[model samples]
Target: MGESVAGRLFSVLDAFEDGGPAALRLTDIAARTGLPAPTALRLVRELVAWGGLERGADGRYRLGLRLRMLGAAAPCPRGLLDAALPELRALAARTGGHADLAVRTAPSADGILCLVSGDRLPPHATAYGKVLLAVPPAVLPRHTRHTVGSPGVLARQLAGIRTAGLAVCAEEFRLGEVSVAAPVRGPAGTLAALGVTVPTGVPLDRVTAAVRAAAARVRPPEPPPYPSP
Candidate 1:
């Protein structure tokens, strides 16, 4: 059977994978999605008009910020962010660094999406990503030269995170940036990770303490009030 327009549209979007390039040329997108050049161009134009995709200054296409705004409204991350934002702000203030909340979008997905971030560092380079990666059903991706690339080495590191109830990354994602994170659990299980990023010069012990404390403060959302019939 022939593919539906909706399916083709999704294929265009899916060509841009998580942890891949931030932008792609028309040819790249067509090649990735296996669409003809004319068809890819038509769909890309439509997506751009609808704010689902963007055309960069260099004439390459990138995922639009609108998608991020929409993703933030997803029920799971939205609830976690609402519960954790206050503590996240306090953590950032205390540590003088970026604070973030991150969760796995799906059990089988390799990357954890940042629901909210107070800084500009890549997710894979931050403590928040490391904490989520430490948990089960997540596979780590090597994002930078500092990333822990070996499976055995990363396994040992994850074990330590589980034992200590916290995770730390020192310049693993970028030089001179250090991050610490702790898991935030809810009724279902491990729901998200709360993390802070600071310069490498900051005291690790203090940052670790602050991150752990902040994680502790995140409570699961209260159930919606029962509606009267």
Candidate 2:
């Protein structure tokens, strides 16, 4: 389908997905969106004027603080995440690994996903990334030798995740690494997932049970569609 006007606008913002706080040159935006340089420049300018994108001292583009504030207020699963934080922390503390609260990106035809991570991990091995990969053909970037490159295998893994109400990875996305995850449901319905990471040889079943127990206590947020222009 041809890009919707809203899609073009969002494409400009999406261009900054990996930029962190750094200002991106015109070429960077163009590369991220596969748009021509002239098109990227025009769209970026529009976003800046809207207070969604900003230019830095070096004359490169970044997400404005205004946009960051909006992101902070976005309503998807926020309530559940808040309720689950203490429990997630306890799980992480007891496990001495990593933890996260993840929600599937709305408007996609895919499996569950994570919204944030509690610690930095190899892009593939991180509990958050792997859960996204648990589904087939998810939008994710590879970051390690153990990353699951095959969509079919990952699809099977996702089924395991759904059936068991948990997912586990043992060197599937990295060497000498493993993790476990459980889905968190809200009073409204399922909204996000909770996960924990531990080194290989740890008992995954036990960790997954703890995450599930925590999820059972919280009410999740209603899944909302992405904002429209």
Assess candidate 2 and give its lDDT.
0.63
Cα lDDT of model 2 by residue, 1-229, tens digit = 8888788778877655542323579887788788888888888888888887778788888666566545434765456667777887888888777777765433342323343442223323445544444444434446566677766766676666667676676776667777776666556544556777688888766777787786676666445677999
Model 1, span 66-154: residue lDDT tens: 77667778776788899998998899898899888887644544445677742223344567766776443234456667887666777
- By summed lDDT, the worst window of 10 consecutive residues in model 2 runs over 115-124
Off by over 4 Å in 2: 1-11, 14-36, 42-69, 109-135, 138-142, 172-176, 187-189, 221-229
Candidate 1: C-alpha lDDT: 0.77
Candidate 1 residue spans exceeding 4 A from truth = 17-28, 55-61, 118-124, 134-145, 222-229
User: How many angstroms is residue 186 displaced in model 1 relative to the true structure, after the best TM-score fit?
Assistant: 1.7
State the TM-score for model 2. 0.62
C-alpha TM-score for every candidate = 0.79, 0.62
On the 0 to 100 scale, the lDDT of residue 110 in model 1 is 44
TM-score of 1: 0.79
